[model samples]
Target chain A: MLHIVNKSPAERNALESCLRVAQGGAILLIEDGVYAATRGNAAENHLRDALSRFKVYALAPDLEARGMGDRVMEGVATVDYGGFVDLVAEHKNCQSWL
Target chain B: MSEGTIKKFMFVNRKAPYGTIYALESLEVVLITAAFDQDVSLVFLDDGVFQLKKGQQTKGIENKNFSPTYRALDGYDIEKLYVEAESLAARGLTEDDLLVDVTVMSRAELGKLMDEMDVVLSF
Candidate 1:
């Protein structure tokens, strides 16, 4: 399964909730959810914890929009909209934690 | 994605419309995915039930009302739309309150249906 989080961890607890149920899958951060990739943000530790259990990805356009390209955590892959479609194709299911 | 590559695609809608763009964007993707000829179904739970509410007045907000689009979904051959019964009851909504026809099911039934999907996308 692919888990997508489009909410900022600061404003919503969806990210935390998503991580708890995610056993082994891919995580994609889109929209305002890209803030999770910003280094030293409030959710950095949780994002780091997710890295060990699942492959993490942040939408490239979203990161660039927030000017967070340089600050994204290491090991987290960056992908475009095309990549988003590909991720959906690769995974058996996608759970968007809105 | 290709001809005859049909897969069971489930879209789990859990957000209300207008307050945010999630519901609208999610609908857009559903339309696009349907064009690919995939077997698609939509499950409306929680605030997502609001998406199907009749007589949504978006003119006050200066937004083109898209609620009517749900009525045309069947023309696209995308007809497997389900609403969680408990969610509707919690919101004090009945099938008569919605604009389109949908199968109302229990949470357990919906969960089992979800497990049968090849892909599940939510908003």
Candidate 2:
């Protein structure tokens, strides 16, 4: 399963909830969810724990838009729109933890 | 709606009340869905648990205190209210702080329940 989270962890618990319920799935952070992929955020430790279970990715454009491209935490991959489509195709199903 | 056609509907509420319109709009939709006689359940997580908090006074904000409507959900037969335990603890709230009776479950339990739903609407 591909779990897509778009809400910022600082503002909402969407990312937190997705992490808790999702077991060994891909997590693609987009929109404000990119905040979690950045360094020194409150959710950084939680995201680190998720790295052990899931392959996490963040949208390149969203990170750039927020000027956080250079601050992305280690182990989190960045993908473009085409890569995003490929991820959707690769996963059996997708859930947007809105 | 036909008896055989009723689907399991779960409404996920994650926003705080008064700060935004999502809570009120979601409540209206929940009430309307109840009219159709579907198997409806409401999940209050994150800041959404605040929606069920008791003794909400909105007179200063000039907003109608809709927290009372949650207690009236039983009359509508929409009593499957679930609150996330972690969310309550993070917000310094307990089951006793809420206006209505609700099953407090862990995130894992709620996630399993979500998987069983035929349809889920998030707010």
Which candidate number has the best DockQ? 2
Among all windows of ten consecutive residues in candidate 1 chain B, which has the lowest summed lDDT? B107-116
True-structure lDDT of candidate 2 = 0.90
Question: Which residue pairs clash in candidate 1?
Answer: none
Root-mean-square deviation (CA) per prediction? 6.0, 3.4
Candidate 2 chain A: worst-modelled 10 consecutive residues by lDDT: A16-25
Q: For model 2, what TM-score is found for chain B?
A: 0.96
Q: What is the C-alpha lDDT of each candidate?
A: 0.86, 0.90
lDDT tens readout by residue for model 1, B1-123: 377899999888888999998888888999999999899999888789999999899988997788988998998899999998877998999999999999998876776677577878777
**Isolated chain A: TM-score per model?**
0.95, 0.98
Give Cα distance to truth, residue A15, candidate 1, Å: 9.0
TM-score winner among the candidates?
Answer: 2
